[model samples]
Target: MMYPPPESQSLKTLLPETPILLMGSGPVPVPQEVATASSIVISHLGETMKKIVARVQLMAQYVFQTKTTKIFGISGPSSAGMEMAIGSLLWPGRKVLVLNLGTFSARFAEMARGVGAEVKEILPQGLAPIYIEQVREAFEKDSFDVLTIVQGETSCGVKNIHLKEIVELAKSHGVLTIVDAVCTLSTMPLPMDEWGIDIVFVGGQKGLSAVPGISLIAISENTFQFISNRTQAMPHWCLDPRRAFKFWGLGEYHYTAPVTGILALHEGLRLICEEGLEARFERHLKCSSALQNSLEAMGFSLFTPAEFRLNSVVAINNLSNVNTKELISLLIKECHVEISGAFGLDIIRVGQMGEQSRFENIERVIRALAFGYGKFGHKLDLESGLKVLNISRDSGKK
Candidate 1:
């Protein structure tokens, strides 16, 4: 039988509209001026807008250090970035080795196989991550043309330590390393060229705090030459990076890059530079730590192990006598705070990304959540948790 919505409308009515806190998906608050700048770029670059494309590619280098790259504005959401990367690189007869620790990794494995590449998955169940030892063993067992891994597993709130080492491993084996930093880039430290990452893809919607439409793919000089040497046909028209590179190099749109999204992404990257990546990383780490400390004191167990936990995000277990789905709805409908459901079951994640990583916002989320949980019939030790949240928030302010 389908479960009924918990908590009466009576409870929801007493709460505020549009939850005062947002701890869900990235796309954190954008500065008024930055938001306006993106809109202005879109309107001003009407019709002949290759300049927008050039600006995006150049700005990406400034922010991400993804030198000599191609930007594609294919028809798909953030997830499409992976498909574009995989479909473009993997040939029909190629073999792919994927080190998957979460849902996105699984999707990558599936997509690679669908493209007719032989795929193998190395995933760790429960709350742990795939360590470097496991990856080394996998590499020894099988040879692969390309090695792919997600930088941050958004599904489980874990960051695999194997990202840098694994990429280096691929380099040693004469295999290409493709990193899915769709959720990690800008939020954390990912130096593409320095780290020898051949192909790196990230979405604008996450830590960049821009609307979802654009995906940034970086191609290294070595990988560019490697792909060009391949005899396989480009699987898709819009995703072909060779075509994109020519257009970007000549400052023209081979296939129109997302004009408006390019604008939004430019502003977003601008803001990141303004804030400084090192400072931003510290803020995200601080915010996630504060949230985790507060939740743990309130008796919420973390689904991911403490050491390997992602600094930009955290996943918490469902409290006793609480339905995760119903609790999430109440958080939105009543408290006006939004969080995401767990990767597997009864879990809720708190995201600290971009402007949402601010101390004030984190405090509001902790306070409102403390109050909100009471309405759900869970006796969350409100005073203790809020006290911890405030302490960390104040510490961060200083």
Candidate 2:
């Protein structure tokens, strides 16, 4: 007899009865279309599954504006996407240059080292964007087989806007380029084919507004040939990109695919297409900008520079008068709102990814922050925050 799927409560379900706003780094609230798709029943390895996979791949192509690049779906989070991209290209004798900006970029370096590839990191100073001049200097000094960079550094809420130029520079040096677009995919400007990116990976949950457990990877023909030429076996069978391509490209199944996650991603991509990429990006920008303006008006400073701030996540420096940890706890306990604390900085992050990138949603978060700060012996200017929201709405932003 077949057993039913195991029953468990998700984090969202475990929260209190109050309506909680998820303005944190990842796993943003899914859109209604995605939630509906998640409830659909489907087999994991059948014709229906094949159709869903193809649809997801096509949607990825449309979202990334790629024509001929091969796309693959992995049955894991964006971390698995990173490993797949790195493990597919890295070998014992290869040199990998990693542009280190925040925690995730460091993880890329670690993955390269794990594969026994000689890794060199070009680290920026204090959460700043990795400059093209720095990358040029690194390239002048040494030769590299592959160069990896994160398009959006979620840990610090910074977006490296010089990616297209960087890709061209890497091409000039005959170095393969890889990008981690986990937080920027579908929410920012990332044209894989136009930029000539060799390999890039994005999370299904962050900007796609789908449920977690899926990673999408796009590969160019040149990168595919490099993987095809590898003679030695991969250290992990699950991380083999060629095998994954066969599984996604052909009907051969390597492992059980997450049917519900794929369905959610399909619906999320459908919504994105319906909304239009430019419109969706504008929505994120307006909402994030308004939130930042309100926060600044309330005497909180932004963590990232104005020129390099990401449109999806906002990092605010903690106030000296109020205990941040206590304020965060009180917000969750009393207001039922959740924001994220930075890994090694005195900052809190608010995300405006996908469906949560709305004026009212951001206004709610501001109100929650005001309430939490007030309860913690700090009087924030709630009227000023609300006024910003009103002006943003009246100005037809978002």
Candidate 3:
């Protein structure tokens, strides 16, 4: 039977045989250590699981660069992490100010509205990062119980470079801050504790380089106390921080945990620790900077401005001469590399997180893109692009 067999075939179709380079928004290639750990099945309530969780929590602290110990993993993608934060802090009659910069930030607004919170969103009118002035303008308009922002807006590669200041501004107004660190968490320096963010959530598949289904959240002590003191009961039982803390914080069982997923995440975090955050951040910067330089030399324009560009997932304008959908398909079919298209914008995203941050991997994807552009009758300066990548790599050795 053919792999991913036709819908007419049985449900137990074989997995695809060839490995395609995942250079899209997320679910990037997992490191060898993470892959090995995921293959082993263990009891969730066993002593072994406890040992792994213990180490993972410490390693996660280093990755987040946060002093908070109220960290735990939820059993889904990053969205699950988002839901947990919302359910724990937001309630009926509460007011939330959402900084709606792009697709991902807009989701926070929708989730806040779902929680029965009075949601007011500031939809910035450009592809640039939300300025401190914009945030200040919103603050002058009204007060909010909670302020939601995406540190790195993945949909457009826009990084809120003013996040630390914005959160400070909200804090001064007695507003709790929840940052969606999904695309930026491990790829860049977040410094959650220093930034005084109440809650920061991330997915395992992105910067963590683990498989999806296991997500993590970092909660400040103040945030935990706020959740505990709230009169309104948490709407979500499974995502409730009170119950989740009992399991991951207090070493008591709240529910059957995703053992395999935790193991994978633990290994992923271990890799981050082994590499050291400073080294990891530098590596990501070099690779991403090289990628941007090469793309520009190849005649592609970056959608996000250089000053506020996100290094994790890059957004580039679609070549006017090439059909983006067809180019993406050709890259997958002929070059075995996968990228992502925007929701409503004429741009394509290339992910540069975890294993994808390596120079060799970046080179591979650049070559694949050049090949695709060539097939579409637009011959990019491939040699110049490669030279730029080489120069960046060489400069990093200094």
Candidate 3 local accuracy as lDDT?
0.89
lDDT of 1: 0.75
Task: Report the alpha-carbon TM-score of model 1 versus the true structure.
Answer: 0.89
How does residue 83 of candidate 1 score in lDDT?
A: 80
Candidate 3 lDDT, tens digit per residue, 1-398? 76785557553464445678999998999988899999998888757777888898999988888888899999888999999998888888899999998889998888888889999988776777778898899889888899999989989898998999999999999999999999777888899988888999999999899988999999998889889898897889899988998889777898998888999999999888898888888888889999999999988899988889999999999887777899999998898899998888899999999999988888989999999989988889989999999998888465
TM-score of each: 0.89, 0.94, 0.95
The true-versus-predicted C-alpha distance at residue 79 of model 2, in Å, is 0.6
Instruction: Give Cα-based local distance difference scores for all models.
Output: 0.75, 0.86, 0.89
Q: Using TM-score as the measure, name the better of candidate 1 and candidate 3.
A: 3
Is candidate 2 or 3 superior in lDDT?
A: 3
Indicate which candidate wins on lDDT. Answer: 3
Writing each residue's lDDT as its tens digit, candidate 2 over 175-242 gives: 99999999999888899888999988988889999888888888887788888898978877887877
Tens digits of per-residue lDDT for model 1, 1-398: 99988866686787674535557756556656557755753433344456666666677775566676555444456667788779877978898988887788888898898889999888775567777787788889988888888888887888887678888878898888888887777878999888888888887777887667677788787777877787788887777777766565565546655666667777888778788888878877887788888888886788878878886667777677777777778777766777788766677777877767877777667766676677777777767777887888678353
What ranking emerges by TM-score with the best candidate at the front?
Answer: 3, 2, 1
Q: Which model, 2 or 3, shows the larger TM-score?
A: 3
lDDT of prediction 2: 0.86
Best by TM-score: 3
